[model samples]
Target chain A: MRQLIDLFVSFFKIGLFTFGGGYAMLPMLQREIVEKHKWATEDDVLDYYAIGQCTPGIIAVNTATFVGVKLAGALGGAVSTVAVVSPSLIIITIISTILRNFAEYAVVQHAFAGIRVAVAALVVVSVAKLFKKGVKDVLGYVIFAVSLLLVFFLDVSPIWVVLAAIAIGVGKALKAGKGGEQA
Target chain B: MIYLCLCWEFFKTGLFSIGGGLATLPFLSEMGSKFGWFTQEELANMLAVSESTPGPIGINMATYVGNTVGGVLGGVLATFALVLPSYLVILLVAKVMERFQNNRFVQSSMTTLRPASVGMVGAAILGVLQSVLVNMDAVRAMAWSQMLSWPNLVLFAILLALYAKFNKLHPVVILAIGAVVGIVCKL
Candidate 1:
């Protein structure tokens, strides 16, 4: 019971504080889940992040679920997922109810204008960090460039990009094995 | 009926929007037009609010749209539906994860996925840049001088420079500063 509450409280804080998006939640998750609670190690968090990217859901929520299940069980998973989303539900409910015509307000618009700029910067920072960690090889760089162009210019679906990348990885592995046998 | 439809749509969104919360934007836009729950302008507002608020943007969006379409009940239902997929998927993965944690195929696939995820994030950055910094309608109308939002561009550059220099400032502080500047300058 104490563990469940701890999971809920920790993830609730993560949900409440993280701003930009799922990626933006990483630092908070690292601090609380990894450093404070010691629920998961840094490597575990990174592994969850990788798995979360491939899975079909919000990355933060997926990570919470993974950690939760690891700590407790299915019930822990349910609690953490709910805890993570609770802040969004409550805040959005309040905003939607109180400010029905949210856009018509000038102050809100200006605030959002400023927030949007910051959000863009946040996204750029996340992209730079991911690029540094991800592009370790020539093939990785090529894949990054190709996928970026494909999504940005051609409006390709990200799922297809991920699928193609998986195929390339498998194909490369097969080719390497063949070369190893020949040598 | 409204509740049911909301659940179904959000469930589909949860099932398909891989990568992260922002990936759901296109689907939400489509839902906006299809359901008439919110206008395109309203969707933009929701995106803004979702960004500034705590929690995953996609879940916030689901709640917002659901509340708009149905009610508080709708909001609850939509949020549950959205997360249901992740709960199930993670549970299943947890079972197999121990066995396959170091499988060659899995490792290679994850390796490739790293770059692909970076690309997706890059695309998301472009989308945000377009929405935040550029006014497409102005560009479409050939109002060349009005295409870029100068104030926003300037603000973005400042923040980018600050981040580049400091590199460790918490994002929340930057957002708070942005809000203050926005309110004071009314930009």
Candidate 2:
């Protein structure tokens, strides 16, 4: 029971504090799950993050669930997931109810305009961080450049981009295996 | 019936929107047109609200759409439905991941996926920049005077400078500054 509550409280804090999106939650996740709780190691968190990126649904929620299950069990997973999302549910409910027509106001419009620019900047920072971590080799850079152009210019679906990357990975692995056997 | 439909729609969204929360934008835009749940402008507003609010943007959006469609209960159902797939899939992966943590196939795939996900994030940044900085439609419509979105550009420049100077400042602080600047400048 204490474990479940811990899971809930930890993830609840994560949900409440993290702005931007799943990627923005990484530093907070590391601090809480890795340093504070010792629920997972840094490598464990990074692995969860990698898996979370490949999976469907929100990466933050997925990471929460993965860590929750690691700490307790299925029930812990449910608790953590619920806890992490609870803040969003409560906050959005309040906004939707109280500020239904707030966006129409000129002040609100200007606020959003500024917020949008800030958000873009935040995303720019995230992209720079991700590039540093992900672009390790020539092949990685090629994949990054190609996928960026495809999605940005052609408006190709990201799902297809991910799928193509997986295929490329598997194909390279198979070729390497064959060459090793021959050697 | 409405609740069921909301669950089904969001479930599909959760099941398919890989990469991250922003990956769901295209799907949400489609939902806006298909379901008539909200107009395009409202969807844009929801995106802004989701960004400013805590928690994942995708989950916030699911709740927003649910509330719009069927009220509070609808919001609850949609959020649950959206997260359900993630819960199940992550559980299964957690079980299998320990066994395959060092598998060559898994490692290789992760190698490729890392860069791919980064690229997707790059696309997400570009999308945000286009929407926030450039009024492409207005420009295309030949409203040349309105093309630059000067206020947003100025705010973006100031914030970028601040970020460059104080590299470790928390994002919420920057966001708060942006909000204050917005209201003060009335931009």
Best by TM-score: 2
Question: Can you list the residue pairs that collide in candidate 1?
Answer: none
Model 1 CAPRI quality: medium
lDDT of 1 by residue, B1-187 (tens): 8889999988887876666676676567557656788765566556656766777888898888888888899999999998899899899998888555665666777678778767766765676688778888999999999999898899999998887678778766677677777888998
RMSD of each: 4.1, 3.7
| TM-score of chain A by itself in each prediction | 0.70, 0.76
Q: Tell me how candidate 2 scores on lDDT.
A: 0.81
On a 0 to 100 scale, what is the lDDT of residue B10 in model 2?
83
Report the number of backbone clashes for model 1. Answer: 0
lDDT of 2 by residue, A107-142 (tens): 887776667677666657766866897789999999
The interface RMSD for candidate 2 is 2.9
CAPRI grade of model 2: medium
lDDT of 1 at B163: 72
* Stretches of candidate 1 exceeding 4 Å from the true structure: A1-56, A70-72, A177-183, B1-48, B56-58, B61-74
